[model samples]
Target: MRYSWLALICIAQLSFAQKKQITLEDIWVKNTFRPKVVPGFNAMSDGKVYTQIDKEGDRQVLRVYDLKTGKQERTVFDNGEHTLEGKQLSLDDYSFSKDEKKILIRNEGQPVYRRSALYRSYVYDMSTGKVLQIDTAKVLHATFSPDGSKVAFVSANNLYYKDLKTGETVAVTTDGVVNKVINGNCDWVYEEEFEFTRAFDWSPDSRYLAFYRFDESQVPQYILPMYTGLYPYNYVYKYPKAGEPNSVVQIKVYDVKDARTVTANVGTETDQYIPRIKWTKDASKLCIFRLNRLQNNLDLLLADATSGNSSVIYNEQNPYYIDIDDNLAFLPDNRSLVLHSERSGYNHLYRWDWKSKRLTALTGGNYDVEQIVGIDEKRNLVFYTAAEKTPVERKLYSVNFEGKNRRTLTPEEGTHGITPIEGFNYFLDRHSTLTMPSVYTLRDNKGKVVRTLEDNAALKGKMWEYDLGNISLRQLEVGDNKTLNAWVITPPNFNDQKKYPVLMFQYSGPGSQEVGDRFPVRDFFWHQMLAEKGYIIVCADGTGTGFRGQEFKKKTYLQLGKYESDDQIAVATYLGTLPYVDKSRIGIWGWSYGGFMSSTCLFKGNDVFKMAIAVAPVSNWRYYDNIYTERYMRTPQENEKGYDENAPEKMADRLKGKFLLVHGTADDNVHFQNAVMLTDALIKANKEFDGEYYPNRHHGITGGNARFHLYKKMTDFVLTNL
Candidate 1:
């Protein structure tokens, strides 16, 4: 009997060992059975969140999650209605009513430009459980009024309103025609530069409709092509590159009660840009932010909705150019606005009091305040995340509005985020490091971490199973003895005796730092894969990269990629001293601005870098956007050296490596022309290189197996080409 029992135990142990050797397909299939994380999040007053998530294999859902737990509560809208009655839909976005019952679900969205899209939106009423269609699926920028009774949407390039109760649709603007007078939503230039999508806003009383009426009639038309191939056939937006004339923009307020439209008497000669309009806390006042084509001067105007009178309350100017208030927030009292400014050399927060017309520095330091998430005025506490203490690290802090009592929270280190309590009593802290996944904890207002909700123990164990490298953060002494922060990830199976190839990744844009103290993202996964196959991944935050100070970051003024190449060459110089590094096999790669840097490295630093892969790079500053290029580099004429001195097009003949230029044909951000022109220059200069053209793909070349296939190709190329 003892022998028989022992035999059974041995068989059970063998079975467990067999199960441990699972394949990637098995893991993927098993992961599909679990709940998926949805992208596109919008928080609601009822402590609920809506997102675009997949439900089964083919269908998608605009689901409502509990936020506290990951449990999904209800399916607000589903899209598989062709054959099945109760099927889930893949909603692009969902907007909630004031009461949190009625939801405007956006679907079948077609892109107009970088920041604008026309969609088939539906109105879902929670009480009746009935989904109603608005604008009959031919609308964009559908927004509900403050009362949530009336829905204002853009259709046929015109503003329209729909009454929920009466089911009546009214055309709000008659002069709205394509390429002439655009109402409700913004034009291509305004949308791309100002980042304005829903141009129209409702008054507090929902009686007035305030919007910008863009006159793009004088703007020249730019066109790209569309082709019918394997996937869906389509045409992309006609985008105007840099040095192009932007649209003439102005503001207008429409009175719903009297049916009177008043174009704000800001006067013509407004050849600049009116990017935003918001109804002030006071029902009578409407606020607008306007900037010139150079984007140097910015004005915050308070316009009287009833009288159509306007007054510039505050203005911000810089020698180079001013940046938009990306994380702008209005105080609860409605008397002041919170703004982010780089005027102090570092990005900080300032309070703009409307009544007094005074500016007060709310948060200031050498580090950048990443974003002001929440504020507790009563407690004199302002909760924000910043790169203080260390640029590579992020932490949450609650300081006084007067900028005192700055205490650090989430002392566990790495990238930290906090969700403060309703009354600023308790807070939820989520933190992670390079080797750790996200760990969530409950903390008090005093920064003491209490109950631990999730530690990501499962994910951490899985990551541990896959051998990782020693990811070290250090500072580099680059050109002219400038200290630069950098990170290096040594291959998992690194050996000092063996020479390993290196891949340098970076996005050397102003105020943009790549060397962050965050957990390994998708890039890390690929980096680990390459490291295991004998390659070192290094990221150097060169000059023009933000966070050190204004002087260090703005050194690339009037130029974008020149200083970056010099500093990256310095990185290669440093790496050559290391015994384990193969200096001849060092390569560089990036997307967009990073791509531009990678191209410059291969051409200018041909002796240092042996290979480069630039995906969707801007070959020239003159071919980029106005707001981005004009900010640091200024106009091409004002500073020709900044624009033409070291252009990738001009340095094409200097290429000494096996360069691979990849670009999506439909990428409006960095046009395919960049690739074509670079390719033409290389060919004319008698240089040998390779390229891959993805037709109908956007800036992010993602689709059914497209991303996976492309990455696989990149892996194979890097392994062989380098």
Candidate 2:
């Protein structure tokens, strides 16, 4: 009711604030706002789900619910302590153990590279109602074993294991070489690309541990500066750039019982990345997903724990590269593996028999398998979400071994996800789109609605009060090959004949889809403010953009920005045809990878786009992490042209439009070096761009007065530039 009252007051304020009288119909709608994505999800292995919820008065609670009943079960966690501990507890992130016995809580985390610090961790034992710290020193990469009897963690590039029973800690690898040596974890390259943090695994019996070791002494180390500011922070980081040598990575196994260590070599030198490693059901064979430096070849090697003998059990190769995702699901039996591949031009699932070494294509179609949700081993059915409904929309479905009996489980759809519970018999779903907030529901295996969960319509009703200018969603078909799919947002009141200036946005990551039919974020607010002032906003999925199938998304394989930038220029050029778009006034922006694309556009497409904003982008691959950069462009050693020709720093001389660059001084992902390098290049080339340096903020730009100030700065930049 108070929100409703506030809306009424805002409407009254709008009456006086408007420069001229306007109607709701005159308002424009665009994909300008960027609503927060569901901040990561956590599922307790016991089939309960916990989601962060906001109450009436800004009280944030981590509410636990029975997935089957859709009933609020308990408050597992919360902000502002209400319990006896009295000390305030907030989570940067958290993970549950296999037995649902322990929770590795992340708190007071600091930024490392692209991700954050492991910092202080509290291992809360649920059964005993006891909370224990991992160590006196803030640890990094603290994780639990399969049996949950001990917790394994990394501190200062070295690995340690904690005994839950005895509360004893032992250093697993004393030779934790830094800059030159790393133990039980990956170097910068592997963390950014392969999406891994800890380079360790536990056996089924929990008696043995498998980990990765890095020798980066030979790898070139690029340097960046740290600054003191309001938060007053200074630090140094060792980074590698495109064409730089990456740490030589190796896999090793440690027998906890015997204190014995054995290095496992796949008997090959091409083991540049160990993306994933899991113990087999037998606890003697370790399954490792290894890829070449180029990332075009993927090998599933089975390493014997005792002898370290390795044999390739499976292999996949693609010209563009195989993505390192949670695509390969090892069934509990360990005899079979469910693999998702884009070999057939579509992301489809296949079942591989490890013992027989035979492959069986399970799901084949033009649509991509968004996720493998549930699988019934006894029934031999695979439950998954697919884009078959619509490229922008997703629905949960189930299919069998023979690809028979494909059934959709949801009628109300937008961007939906499921938490299958009690071994796939039931599920809890949270779904929403741009036009709506999320609604949670409970459903059964037969696709029948079992219970009502939550409908976020109230949030939408509350939003109706704002004097949001006219917003419209439009499609743009533009790219290098004239093959691009894009979406645009127009400010509230808009007229086609007025030729409003355009501001463009995009993520443009390898496997990320930014222009999906999802809730918009604060960018929408900026767009609304822009629309109120007469501007159009646009974003597109250029080549190398995700979920469109292999050929379409992989076109930018070697040269990361070539097609993406061209597509952005094309989109802006096509906007010139809209009669409402002022082609010469079009500007662009994005964060991280998006920032890379935005910078690339301002330089390569200078003739079309007038200005650009890049936040925390990689100016060169050599300065980025190895696992990610090598995947798309291979090593700079192998594809110097790909890394060199299109880098923002390399193309700094071509800048023609206004440019504003923003980055967190502590950004770990893309690194602040990206912006510094580009700035240096711009200076060397006598090119000028607006820049802002956020002190002590991480990749997400979160801190006091940080996010709000960032939005304010971006709003000012877009308004002034376009």
Candidate 3:
């Protein structure tokens, strides 16, 4: 009888070991674990329902759903029924006007850069069901005016406005030549770094249009070769590198009634950047964000549109650098504005009064406020997400305008993302944990769950079929004596007695967090595939990562890759001491900034890492863009040692590991020149390394079978080397 029981237990163990394992094809090729997502949900003006984009046949439709019952209320627009220019209209995206009387439709959007796209725009009136194209030419950042009487757009690098009723088009600016002047849209650097494509704003009363004009003729151009034709074509555009001359920017306000333009009294610093501009509740005042070239000083300016005069309402200064965020919200009272500041060594919400010229703290804590969800002026409550509960998780909280009555809204122990309705009476909570798929739920303003919109049960059921790994979240103390967050994934059949090879991944960019409790859909599957192959996958959020506070994030400020690499090396050193870790076979890998880190780690941490993979890495700070590189390293000219000491191009001779460098030739973000330069350095150093390039692929390196091929190659490299 004892032998029979032992045999049954052994058979159970064998069955568990033979469970279906995750495969690379299941992750990349078959896409067996992709989760269903709720895309493009916008709250309606009525505050009871939301509109979502849906597909029917080959056409797109705008369907509205009741927020309470999660049922389709009606379809607002269907591309199958709409015709433009005697052709079936293709709806790329749509936005409603302020009063919801009209819709701005975008079609045939061609992306120019990271955040800038040229689209053919049309205005559809709900009352008359009539559609009119805004312009014959493709335009960028087209939108209906606040009053819905006109539409403004940027075409041919120039700003134009069309009077909907009169059908008269007026050019706001005309000196908009290619590679010289840009009127209403941001340049590549501003679009990529400042995170804005539209460089124009409509005033509250729709009387004035505030826009930025850029003169890029003096800025040097970077040429990228496109391999689409027999003879490769060169695509050239103005791109300023580190320590290079930037476009001279000007802020101007156009008075609609007077048909005149007035230049705002921004300082005469041509190198400075005007990052943001928005109209205040009082139409007379326009809020402008001005930052110096060093990005250490940020000024919040209130400009008088009529007089073209401006005054500094608030001055923010940081010793290292000031960060830009979407946190400037004007109150309905027209006398105060809510601003995000790190004055207390953490990002918090503060109210700035125009009359008193004083700043009052509205939210105060050691933790950083992640975002401002909504402001309920009538209730004197400000809803926001903060890292009060845990750094890896975000929780919704509401506090009074005076920093009282702080209450946590989310009870679940994971990352909670909230999309509040018009009046903050209801919100859509998309919650997820490390092991759980995203669950979308509609909740009241007070945090009661109304209904579940999407539970991703299909993907959840498929996840059980695979013998996925077990994730363990831990904190390890690094060389700086600070605890860093890390996540380790072990195989389902993990044995404590056996030492497993480890693969470490990190993207240690400034103010970026990767080690969160949120589920990683595709990447998680890839990690599980690796785990099934008898390897451990680990991700550590090192120094300079966000959600901790200002000090921890800014530790590697001037020296971009120095502290970040050190923390990774320190974490690896600690992990090496573990009993189940095979220290001699450890590897490190990353992409973009992560790629940059991986290269630096393999070079500087050569004593620890045995293999490394870097994809689309910035070889040197000088080769990167002006805005991002300068903000962190203050240009190669200003801090030559900061740029030279940590750059992987300079450390090519220190490569002591099995290195694989992969890059996309058409990666405009981190240009292919970076790879060429580093390859030259490696050749000069007589270093042996493996390299691969995807022709005509962008930074993401995705299209058709590109991603699957790349991951397959990477998997083989890991299996052979690590």
Residue 401, candidate 3: how far off, in angstroms?
A: 1.4
**Each prediction's whole-model lDDT (CA):** 0.76, 0.75, 0.89
**Candidate 3 lDDT by residue in tens digits, 90-172:** 77888999998888999899888878888889988888888899988788999888899999999998999999999999999
Q: Of the candidates numbered 1 and 3, which has the greater lDDT value?
A: 3
Candidate 3, backbone clash total: 1
Q: Using lDDT, give the best candidate's number.
A: 3
Candidate 2 local distance difference test against the native = 0.75
- Alpha carbon lDDT of residue 491, candidate 2? 60
Estimated TM-score for each candidate: 0.87, 0.85, 0.96
lDDT of 2 at 517: 66
The regions of model 2 sitting more than 4 angstroms off are 1-65, 68-107, 122-133, 229-234, 469-473, 479-483, 620-622, 671-673, 680-688, 695-699
Number of colliding residue pairs in each model: 6, 45, 1
